[model samples]
Target: MTTTANTSHNIVFLDRDSLIANVRRPAFSHSWTEYGATAASEAAGRLAGASIAITNKVPLRADTLAQLPDLKMIAVAATGTDIIDLAACKERGIVVSNIRDYAYASLPEHTFALILALRRNLLAYRADVQAGQWQKSDKFCLFDYPITDLAGSKLGLLGYGALGHAVARLGRAFGMDILVHKRTPVEEEGIRSVSWDELLETSDVLSLHAPLNEQTRNIIGSTELARMKRSALLINTARGGLVDEAALAAALTTGIIAGAGFDVLVKEPPPEDNVLLNLHLPNFILTPHIAWASTQAMQILADQLVDNVEAFVANKPVNVVG
Candidate 1:
């Protein structure tokens, strides 16, 4: 693959630290300048004279795109491209490509980790053991917490894509009955489909793997939480906006659902007033969007990122979004 040279093209990476994985600099013939971090205000100045720009979470709205006259392509380092203005890119004739299926391994493993923790009440039990409550008990162990098993339980999955399928495989291995909700109400031949309402009511464990969009935003609100069985567990390794954080907090506080495990939030590094931050409920587990950040997954992402850049330079791009 040919790289952009002094007179050929200039490549710029807006936020190189976002990947958390090692990226081997491509042997492209182009002159590449990467910034470890870039602020929203500095984006335009940083993209000056660049033929290709790369970003992970940094926003690239219409106003920002209008400033970069030379930018020909945008290569997102991550899978989700909601942060970018795809319509604006099309209007400007700027090609966009993103890494796909890089998290197939890490995400499903993380989903199961959350499910197991909630099922066993691991956090609460550990806390009780650490506080010497077990020593105070006359019996060998205390039954203060409830523990559920995966066998014979129903697993309802939303957004039955690659990640959801992987989760289903794990569920089957655990002897759990897996049910997938159709994206729409249409029926299929081989797959066992459930309506959204039925899935919410019947599932022992509900896991979300859907993307964030207008129809999906805040899909799991108070009404949906009310539909779940009091013993059911909710797991979201998907986007944060998929569930209403405030409603989730209320559900946990009121025991509307058994427990919840989430990897993503509506806001990253959520504000101080975020309700989930103040929740100390044993039934809740939250991780800072690391489900897709395993070392191996990050390596795949990095390798594919360079591949996208190379393809764009060759004028034969792959994984184009715009």
Candidate 2:
């Protein structure tokens, strides 16, 4: 518990506009400067005399970390710390803290929004109405595409952490049974832990909440897609690298699975050549990563961010990351 001997620590927030929350000033006296965005080339220079750094997506590589001897702590505004070099930060004696569980409610609500929209064929029907299907309909309503209900369906959840549990609670309210996938094939009492093969094969709705790492990257590939029920819906509010973009597009086009609702992609602002962007399928719903950007969640994250910095400076840091 090494308290910051200095009363005024120079703080620089690399990306402020990225979050839409009302960030309150820290309790103790400090010099604060913020920028809308910080490019890689500008990171070192912007952090030249800063002792505390705040960032959301800006990458601080080993080379850049080495240049800032004055930097003592990094307050990450998001849960994922992959953008920061943890090894380098540890070696340099820099304390790293990250926001967590701030999206527990926002993410689950967004997940259900996607599920309800896709399951009820909202997009497909809207397109039909816009294309003049109702005016020319021989009947009262259009039933060209199948519509499904969430009740009595099986929801297979991967990585049952805070987010996953929140989703499960919502699924149960919709009269759906929850099947948690066993990453290690262990059977837990009271909770049904299903095999990966079973989860992929039988689920009516498969939701992902896993983190992206070596073991989880490309976890849902062509082979996995082929095993799913043709009526099942795949929802990924997690990392985009967890699924193969090409395979997902093919799956939706060929009816390998019913639909997919995603809030993330392998690349943000994906290049022109990205396959998912060109699909233009109603069954494939894509959002611009707003699953965790609700006003409430952003405020919670912002509050925690300032708390992390204040605690660290007081020598009782919370949410310290390795």
Candidate 3:
């Protein structure tokens, strides 16, 4: 592979600190500039003469893209390209490439981590043990919380993509029967998918792997949650906006669903008043979107990120996103 990109190329990495991996210097010589984190206000200025721009979460809308006439390509550090204005990039003839499958190992593992913890009531038991519930029980064991085995239970998967497939494999190992729905109009011929209603009604554990878009935003709300079995568990490691955080908070309080495990939320570092943040229920577990941040996974992502840049400069872009 050709190393350093075009020598005259000016590359600006907007958020170098997002990845925990050590990014190697490009093979082709180029002037490189990076920032630990960048605000939208500082984006265009920092990208003044940059031939290439790299960003993880920073949004590059049409207005911002309009100013970067020198930009030839954008190397998105993550898989999701919603942050970039793809139409504007296409209009300007700028290439946009994003990393994919880098988190296959880490993401599914994290999903199961949350699933096992919630199903077995790991946190509640641990909290009770620390609070001296075991000592106060005066017995050999304490059955303070419910424990549900994953084996023989049904798993409702909203997506059947890479991450979803991996999670399904793991679920089968634990003896789970997977049920998935086909929401899009186009799918493989001859195969039928379950309806959304059936998936919600029959699922013992409903896991979401779908992205956040107009058709999917807040797909799981009060009505959807109400359709699920009272013992059903909900898991979301995909996008947070796919779920209604307010409804989820209400569900946990009123037992709309048995438990939930989420790694993403509608807002990152959500405002202090986010309802989900205020809920103190052990059944409602929330993580700050670390499902894909395993150190090894980040390393693979960083390596591919540079690889995309190198290939683009070579006049053969890979992983181009629409």
TM-score of 2: 0.94
Candidate 1 off by > 4 Å: 1-7, 184-191
Per-residue alpha-carbon lDDT of candidate 3 for residues 1-322, written as tens digits (9 for 90 to 100): 0123356889999988888898876677698888888998889998989999999998899999899999999999998888899999999999999998898989999999999999999999999999999989978898989999999999888987888878888888898887878556324432236789899999999999887777999999999999999999999999989999999999989998999999988888689999988889999888888999999999999999999999998988999998
Candidate 3 C-alpha error for residue 71, in Å: 0.8
- lDDT-wise, the better of 1 and 2 is 2
> What is the TM-score of each predicted model, taking all chains together?
0.95, 0.94, 0.94
Worst 10 residues of 2 by lDDT: 1-10
Error of 2 at 36 (Å): 0.6
Q: Please, what are the lDDT tens digits per residue for candidate 1 over residues 132-231?
A: 9999999999899988899999999998877887888898889898878866652443346888888999999999988888899999999999999999
RMSD, every candidate, angstroms? 2.7, 3.5, 3.2
Error of 1 at 83 (Å): 0.6
* Candidate that would win on lDDT: 2
Reference-based lDDT, residue 268, model 2? 82
